[model samples]
Target: MITKKPTNKRLGEILRQANLVSSSQLEEALSEQSQTHNRIGDILVRRGWVKRETADFFATHWANLVNETEKPLKQPLGHYLKEAGLLDDEQINTIISEQDQGKLWVRLGASAALKGWLKQSTVDFFVEHLFPEQASDSPFTKAKSSQKTAKGRRSWFFSQMK
Candidate 1:
């Protein structure tokens, strides 16, 4: 089982960090949320600023990714990405099939990026933030250090999307 440290990050913050939604967009969603009492994810999806799956993914897993405690991830990176609504069944199957047939040594995140299903930055975000141990030797770690410096200035919220 995987366990995470406590965090105060919110869905909007995570989405913003991922470069999925802009600050103005998040502010608009929040303004609407104030009046409707609807979920921020729902508002963002309705506005088309973010995909339903992306919103759902962050809503579900942002906490686990930000936790400071080191816990073993029980599954591969693809598993969490799928649950985060980043990857679908067909995408996973295609990646696996290609790996088996071609004997490709590519990681799932790289495969997904190469196929254009996800941006490289998104995969990098998951690797650097969610699974730091796997990323220690990866070139992606270079960016992680820079991100940590910026992270201190960001505000966080404890509200859940739902």
Candidate 2:
């Protein structure tokens, strides 16, 4: 049996964190998987809790992304999120357009978070793991450190304007 990395979240956990499925639904699916001897992704897809592509992306491509250390990622964070079913083409286009209109340089992940399309933890996970080299340079990290209180939280780019 293939084992997942300790740092990597399971497919169900990822789906839950992304708010794609409810906890009760996941538990029910897990129960069915125990009796059906089927892949969790397949079970979820069959139940219509998740789209086929979304399940496939997590089952097939997620491991590759997590374990990819030899090759540097050429695509931006939005690409991965979209592939993972967390984002759609429209959202990606919107983010890109917004970035283009902004004067300051903001990471795509930061912009997504600002728009409430992604959670801070989710962005942090990708930046810290997938783009370790760029993590320190990320405005999210800088802002998180500087703003200890939630009310004071602001991206470095926005903070610079004041």
Candidate 3:
């Protein structure tokens, strides 16, 4: 008997389930993809229907959940957070500025928590939900919470004045 293991959901399905991209947006992107021979994510990004970070998140996690023969995507964390409605682009940009100005690099999840933009537990939930395969071994699992340290915080004044 040729038995087949269940296939993971497609990128569009994953993005929709996560509430990252609307059905119309996905359809449009898919249509564009058919004509351009480009990645749906790229098409969505180019069309400004979905942010690059959001597309990357779906592509990366989808790749992780699929069979090894498939290629994995290198996506950002912002998409998952955005899809979950824990954070938005403005918040992410602020966090990015902070990280860029900080003496030491800080993780996005930790920065969001420190800024009261998102709860650490919420970040954990999304991380576990999106990247089930890597959740147990990732830094998110080890930290147990956002990284809190004086050095980790960015100086708002320093960056603003510059």
Candidate 4:
């Protein structure tokens, strides 16, 4: 009797969905893997597209999710930011309270940034790293991207004036 090997889910797809690897980066890694016959994770790491520890974390997260050994928590945005080390408990509480009081109408990360508790880049990093779906679906995210594009065009227009 022959027993077939159990196949694991695709790590590349998981990583891409997590926003750890862009489609272009994954494509490059796939191309390199085809040429070198190396594992995609190794190719990504070797090419400096992703850090080894990040790859390991996502791989482990996927394995745990697939094996039913662990269930991810659907926590509040403040909790997620606190867990990501981007916001302290006090800062999270402040943001939550402000939101509750109708004094703030932004997401947790944006609130933190607006309050000067965290840098915009720090919020962006944690949001991308920990909540890729939110990054893609968020209206705040869309506004931020549009703001960047407008800022770039305004700068170009001003630079041309000089």
Candidate 5:
């Protein structure tokens, strides 16, 4: 049976959990690796900062060492974070900015809507409960009534000034 991978909460946290080296040492190794433009695992091994076995282990396991594209959708949030159960559905739901190749899907959808590329029905469908019915003139004016009755929610709804 296959087991879930662990999440990289933070690089520092990973170092702490691994307990292979002190934070200061790890910080120094990380800094040196950055200055030398060398991979962290490689630099740590060269400096004897960590054993080859440990380096190899972290090389494949460390959160920072792996490329994001190496595993997409498999973990959704991330292989390390999600598989480790560190991320929840709510957190995953906020992934509006992540992109692949040259396209940002959310942005593309928004642009399409703004350009009238998408029908009002499509927007309503996509937004789910946020936007009310397309028929703003109908007795289903609960959206407007609510908009006026709740000042804060109204502001929240239309507060994008820029």
Candidate 6:
């Protein structure tokens, strides 16, 4: 059977919900994915953290992003920073490559550090720095609670309908 392709936002939410990624990590990956046309799973795999088959399975199984709460960011690091008025692409690349040796997570930090997207010394500097303030300060809270509350909420919805 053909697998359904979840929207980028939905994919991020799923990963966050599954505890596979923190909200901040998902956000960074999503932002990075948008620019490169790479799937979120692909990048994670490239980072040596996730495997391809598992990603494919998740991609095939989960629902799409039709009702996602937000849009996914996909701009390449340099372009994204430049658009944000943070730093030019070349400068961003130089720092990220220099700092992380082209590692995905490190590169994220490099880009942020170079462009001042976030401070250099932050923990996992690239991963946690610059998390959006509006993200309820915890990106996947809803996703986690939903799993626990699913059966109860569904019953409530059905009772109301009847």
Best candidate, lDDT-wise? 1
Residue-by-residue lDDT tens digits, candidate 4, 1-162:
212222276877766664567899998888887898988888878888666765665555535433432343344444544433345656765655665566755766787778887666656655554454455555343344233333343343344334
lDDT of 3 by residue, 1-162 (tens): 112234467777676655556788888888877898898878877887667876776577544433334443233456557653457767876766755666325567767877787666655545555444445544423233334342333342234334
Give the alpha carbon lDDT tens digit for every residue of 1-162 in model 2. 222243477888777765667799999999998998888899999999888888888778866876875656665566677777667777766655554555434566787778798776777766666666666675633334232332222332234334
Candidate 6 lDDT over 1-162, as tens digits, reads 222233444555655554445677777787889899887888776875444654554465333322223554332323333332334445554553443442333343344554565444431321222222222323222332223333343343344334
* TM-score (all chains, Cα) for each model: 0.70, 0.65, 0.42, 0.42, 0.32, 0.32
Residue 73 of model 6, lDDT score? 32
Q: Give lDDT per model, in order.
A: 0.68, 0.67, 0.58, 0.57, 0.40, 0.44
Q: lDDT score, residue 57, model 1?
A: 75
Q: Best candidate, TM-score-wise?
A: 1
Cα lDDT of model 5 by residue, 68-129, tens digit: 33432221112233223333333332322222222333332233344454333433322221
Question: RMSD to the native, candidate 6?
Answer: 18.9
Q: How does model 5 score by TM-score? A: 0.32
Cα miss at 138, model 6 (Å)?
Answer: 27
Off by over 4 Å in 1: 1-6, 34-37, 68-70, 136-162
Clashing pairs in 5: 7-80, 7-81
- Model 1, residue pairs in steric clash: none
* Model 3 alpha-carbon drift over 4 Å, by segment: 1-7, 62-162
Residue 161, candidate 1: alpha-carbon lDDT: 14
Positional deviation of 50 in candidate 3, in angstroms? 1.6
Which of the predicted structures, 4 or 6, would earn the higher lDDT when compared with the native?
4
Overall local distance difference test of candidate 4: 0.57
